[model samples]
Target: MNLKARITRTGAILLGKYVACDGFDEQQPIRVVTHVHADHMLGLRESLKKCEMVLMSEATRDLIDVLKSPLFLMAGNVKTLPYKEPFEYKNEKITFYPADHILGSTQVLVEDQEGERILYTSDFRLPNTPIIRSDILVIEATYGSPRCIRNFEQKAESVLVDLVDRGLCEGPVYLFGYHGKIQEVMEILWKNNIRVPFIVPEKVFHVCKVYEKHNKKLGRYWLARSEYAKELRSKKEPFVAFYHMAARRRFIKEKAYKIFVSGWQFQEPIRQVNEKGFVIAISDHSDFEGLIEYVRKSKPKLVLTDNYRIGHAKILAKEIEKRLGIRAIAVPPTKPKKK
Candidate 1:
């Protein structure tokens, strides 16, 4: 009846010996993928190879069908479970909740036979995110620093639209981010009534089609090399081009504006890098305040902040203990917790 939740040195989230989340651990038989982001999919191949079964949301599964090489979804071990449906194993039950981070992102809650619960908030934004209660809470520390709070989060959409509007007035505007994030910006433009044609790379076009299949509406867009896009380019009209950050470069020749969309900036939501360059702090993950707020709402007795990711894990653990009076620790540490 001893159920534990902690991150391993290899960035694996192990719930006892039963489940591994995001990362992979051999001892864990079931692998639960929270999302499709590369960082969260560490040791995914190993997990798929050795683990008994791999679990993810249906959208996450569909996304893998598009993004991965050699057709990843064709495997029999991969399973897609709907949200709020508890799947019972030998002596435990697991459930998925919407993470609000990406298309198929989720927060996992595992309950032992004795009713002890452990919730993993892998990557999520606080807005409209459900707070799942648990005895042991394992959370991401991507924006966990006390000073990492974004005051202008509510204004990110407006700022982005304004930037695009101004950029489009002059020439074609380029928007860059990861898969889900760039699609989010596209939805924002559509919602704000930014009526200009969208041109995206091949993979990006496919990802947007997936979003549409999931009932997420995006404005009219075309593939970069398609005849429609070429026609729009010939017109010399303003168009927005979307590219994943990894593939972004000097592809467009005209005086086009470039905007990098990410959540790393803390100073302002919209940061002007140069005359034609801008950085939008429109993040998918929760900020420091949102992380703390999740902790406060869930009221977990023991909290573990993930130290494996890029942000301030130790600082978040310290802040959690100091501010919420909860027993908090950063995972994969050298020293044992002082009880």
Candidate 2:
């Protein structure tokens, strides 16, 4: 089969693949942002210049502006599309749905005239998360491994409660994660009636403010650089604070207890910290079961995945075809191999 025949036969395209274009080059990019996590967006700068147009959610655009500095050059080549709106680009009609991963993450769906559709489910979480909507039928799998199943939230919460009970009743509780994850932690605390004065990095706090503007109540916390420092210092009740890795040690003093959250914690320096303090697996990515359910619902003809989870995606595809009798196969990641 010719290249066009192959692409036409299977309605799918990997990250660095071409559809009605030459080989997918970072310089020849099309509108693509599979959630706002750093890993998913590593090469976006190079990719942006390649494509004729760029499309993503408004919130994502705002967050990217904050994340990227001297944002003038990087911010110019994009257009913000509303959620689920059908837009035409590269002669194809496409729609974007909420990925439920982060505040402004999205899953891209492209529909052609022949009724063939391809959905790229950026990293997403099926369970209830703060400030994001869960899509019943998503596409692709970023977390399709059996090891993905975990009870990090429940386990971490129990440990946190115990640690809080043992604390001096007024010491600060330092919790660490990315900006978006920190907001999620704060939301969980609020829902469980674990109210406390919390701290987050200034950048994360800015995003939280955006969430609050949209009326998603997170927590009654102050930015570390914000006013009311005296009030936070004088706090006598339980408190929660979020910081980046660089700021972890300084904020987490001998008196203050520390907690780390993320799937990454199941490994590395995080595991080291878990020995003493606490680590939670509250992730924004889907688990194995969630990934399968999403694939079955979407019913795409072919599958594509990132390198780390490519095998997991392929395994899930096999199970899906066996159970539902659907034709599905896993495709390579955008990059042939990691550098």
Residue-wise C-alpha lDDT for candidate 2, range 78-184, written one tens digit per residue: 77778778877555666777767778787666665554565556667675422212212224455565565654545656555555444426477777777677777
TM-score of each model, in listed order? 0.95, 0.77
Q: Name every residue pair that clashes in candidate 1.
A: none
lDDT of each: 0.88, 0.57
lDDT accuracy of residue 168 in candidate 1: 88
Report the Cα RMSD per candidate.
Answer: 3.4, 5.6
Counting clashing residue pairs in each candidate, in order, gives: 0, 2
Residues 129-239, model 1: lDDT tens digits: 999988999999999897898999889889899989999889889888998999999999999999899999888888888899999989999999999889878887789
Best by lDDT: 1
Q: What TM-score does structure 2 among the candidates reach?
A: 0.77
Query: 249 in model 2: Cα distance from truth in Å?
Result: 4.4
